[model samples]
Target: MAELVFDYLIIGGGIAGTTAAETIRQKDQNGSVALICGEPHFLYSRVLLPEFIRKEIELDKVMLRTAGDYKKNGIDIFLNESVCDFNSQTMTLKTISGKEFRAKKILIASGGRPKLWNFETLLPGNIFRLQTLDDALKIKEFLSSRPSGTALVVGGGFMALEFIAILAKYGWKIKLLCAEKYFWPDFLDETGFGILKDLWQKNGIETIFGREIKNSAELDADFVGVGIGLDRNLDFLPHAAIKPPSGGLEVNEHLETGTPNVWAAGDVASYKDRFSGRRRSGGNWSGAFMQGRTAGLNMAGGKESFKNIPVYAISHLGVNISFVGDVGPFDEKFGVKTEEIRFDKEKKEHIKIFMKDNRVIGAVLMNGQRFLGKINQAIMNGWADSKITLD
Candidate 1:
């Protein structure tokens, strides 16, 4: 309804957007900043959503910042406003509510939304996806009824696994289906998956690896939950501005999208990986926050670049898991040493380390947190430059 001008406009209130806003404030305190979040609530950690479902944390504690906090930081907060269309040439953006705004610079930090199955169907009352806080609350409300039926969860990522673990604790008959050979194929190897497979069996949760849902009929449960994958939110913007294979707004090293006066971070922005030689999109909160900060600095006329140092970590039902650095399939072409380790019979934990020239390049560990800090430090310290003889 009204047009407002600001030095920088951030289009998301997730980890990336909020972090970018803070970065801009830190760099240029004098510049006017505006943030528009589609969700009515303030930012919360998506990584800890599962914990919230498990009742590990309270709902009030999940909120990352309060409205008063934003006002204290001198940021204009606009809630429940999703940018529908953007014009690069005119430096203007229109929200779904038909409000228009102009800014000297824009940061598209909008995060990903959960991909649903059979989206055309109108069975929203029973089915759900755990992407937003509202979705979590809905699921919790459903569970509060103590439904005398089983719940089926689809997908194989951390989200699916965490849900399975939580539901199992509530004595719900659970069926978890993953259409992959391993639980987290991007981060785990066969040995690590074997460990998780054992854990799932011990917990009495059904798992179907390397198999997918052929149809909705195949899911025989009280409620069918499907969140098989994630997709970018760049559909609101023009596709010509993006590069290929990313399905994300293409950004340079500095998080600068080719679009004039616009940048992006988090799950919506894609950049080439220096080590894997493949374009990468980030979904984790840690990387999202860092990328958001970098983008914010540049958009505020300061200097910043996102250096890729990807790390993935998750804990479920008291088991700790982490993966750091470049994890790749075993290949003789890359000249690497792959080691797989399984510890104990009762408490079997999986550990796999990928090495090149006798230095650890990547590692996957389950039920191990001590080594993660060391491995993370080793990777950051550039220990790959030195080679050592191993027994």
Candidate 2:
């Protein structure tokens, strides 16, 4: 029944929310700012969690900020607190612990969570998902305590690849089981997938396709690593019908939520792309961090639009896999066309371009090339992809 008031409020404690808080302080120092964090710990790097789990980096390296830092900046951070109810009409948020936070403006940076199978009820300790720092710590601990054994990784994205790498290093038998036969068929072309598949085989990692894990025991894995997908954490959104086409909070170029005194950023924002005019959500850490800055600027009485070419890159299985822009579901309905090319024959480098109306919209590259900058610029301006040359 405690009531707190602030000039501005941020819901997530990830990079987005933390960056937004810092940006808000820079813009309006006197504005009372309150950040409600669902996690008990302060901000940390989600991108580094994989490296930490792999033991390539120390746990202390993952910590990005301390409570002292927030206090120094005059930001009130409520860790281990989450909103249970939201009243958009009054701009009021009720926490799970019955604390009320009233703010003149609010930001939604709640991000997303790993999608897990309900099998946790049957085998709790064996099922794992790597989405947070805690998840990485627990996974590392689990591996340290148990002997190397068969591991089943169910996913087709970056997280699944990370799990494979970590398990393989631990000298465990690893099998990648995903429902997609061509993994990222939307963005990655046949050659890109072929390259990855070949690399997987070279590393002695088995690949299983067109399958779903209904029974954990049936897979014969000592444990399961689930990275099937990321679900937007909209639990605080209530039953309100404000969801956008991307399944996150709908936002304009300025990151405004289209609701009075509200804005959204990071993984939880389904913002209209400044280039394509299509709505999409960005999952990469850099994208979230920049979006938070843009949202913070606008929320502090300045008008600014978020415009960044979405880029995601990861080194896995002895190759560099990079994706830019809105890859697949290019919506043939929108007259989208795709082309794949092997840019470097000797190095086995490949690129796939997805376009509509001859404008570059998205692309994927394996063993990526230097021309990535041109691709980004072309996608940003909706420029004709014809001028983008590998040479």
Candidate 3:
């Protein structure tokens, strides 16, 4: 066992941990900082993993920061260190490789591992879960061979949809099944989802929603990819602290967890949206980066607020989709001016916009052309509640 002390110890090398470290260095140049990441590669965007699989993006392009960048800032980086446990009383942590480190404050940005099926035996080699850069590279290799047969994708979300879109373009038989009736249910309403359904079906990808995967052993395919969501990697901490059992670490408006001197960020952390004040969980890259920066600033003895306007975006099947501010559920509560356009009703071209007062609170477009910059700006500038007169 080895012992060391630092001003801050960040557990997780993902975007959250990286941003936290950078933010800390930006604020306090004299304090010691250490970052522990399980993966050997530098910090990369987990959201772009699917796109990397489709060959639409190169590995180097999506990688934002490198380990060397952190080291230059005087922050110690530990790669390939898998944390096994943490003790708050001693302010120490033990890794699976039988190493120990002590610090003044710890930030758990370890993130989450993909949820895999609990099996009595090792599942077949064809099954895959895309949670890391290596996983995406492996899938890329698997697809390069152009293995004969269709892909059965399980789950419904931004990642699942992106996977289906990219894989379908590669000329592989694709069968997408989800347990929800609509795609991106959290962001898109029934009308918006209907538009996506039409586009997906038109592309020759069959989708079945609101259905559970009863058994995978009976099903056979050239390959299977599952995106059943993620669970917060909080087994090392007491369960009672984090409320809302569905999400990961729990925090107040300030992003502080139940444990003293322990803060959380990234997909592993859940907090209230600044606008709606409702508990929200976002596994997206933007959310993780922002949260990590806020946590780091706070940990470094700076007084900063974590409040922020909601932001989300994705590109699939030539459709660029983005959402900002309080959308969806807000449509019902707020009397927003709503407009919809369905081009070629039979062809499934539609776009819907929800404007509260005069600002854009939400929108959905599928197989249609509509620039999103204006809408996103309106939402962030607090113009969503203004009265508008369209030209």
Candidate 3 at 161: error in angstroms? 1.2
Model 1 lDDT tens row, 1-391: 5698988899999999998998889888899999999998888877777678777789887877988889988999899998899898899989989889999999998888877576317556677688898888887778767754788888877678767766876678888888887687856766677777777787777888798767757766766677677877776788686666667887888988877788989998887655444567877778898899889888878666688667888777668887766665444566766676445445656666666766666777787666666666655554552331121
For candidate 2, lDDT tens digit of each residue in 1-391? 6689999999999999999999999999899998999999999998899888888999789999998999999999999897888888999999888899899999989888876466767777688889887888899999989899999888888888989989988999998988887777677767777788888898999998877777656657887888878888888786463564578888888988768889998988888776666778997989999999998999999898887888899888678888888775656676778887446655768888878778888888888747688788878777776778776
lDDT of each: 0.77, 0.85, 0.74
For model 1, where is the 10-residue window of minimal lDDT?
A: 382-391
Q: Against the correct fold, how does model 2 do in TM-score?
A: 0.96
Residues 1-391 of candidate 3: C-alpha lDDT, one tens digit per residue:
5587888999999988999999999999999999988888888887777767878789898798876688799989988888887888888988888878899899989888877565313455777778889888888898898655778887786668766766786787888888887677755667778667767777888888888766756446677777777777766666565566335777766678878888988877878765444566666677788889999999998657676655566666766566655555443554655666344456445556666556565556554434455555555664543432222
TM-score for each model:
0.89, 0.96, 0.85
- Provide the lDDT at 227 for model 2: 86
Candidate 3 — which residues are off by over 4 angstroms? 118-122, 326-391
lDDT against true structure, model 1: 0.77
Evaluated with lDDT, which candidate comes out highest? 2
- Model 2 clashes, total count: 0
For model 2, the local distance difference test gives 0.85
Better candidate number, 1 or 3, judged by TM-score: 1
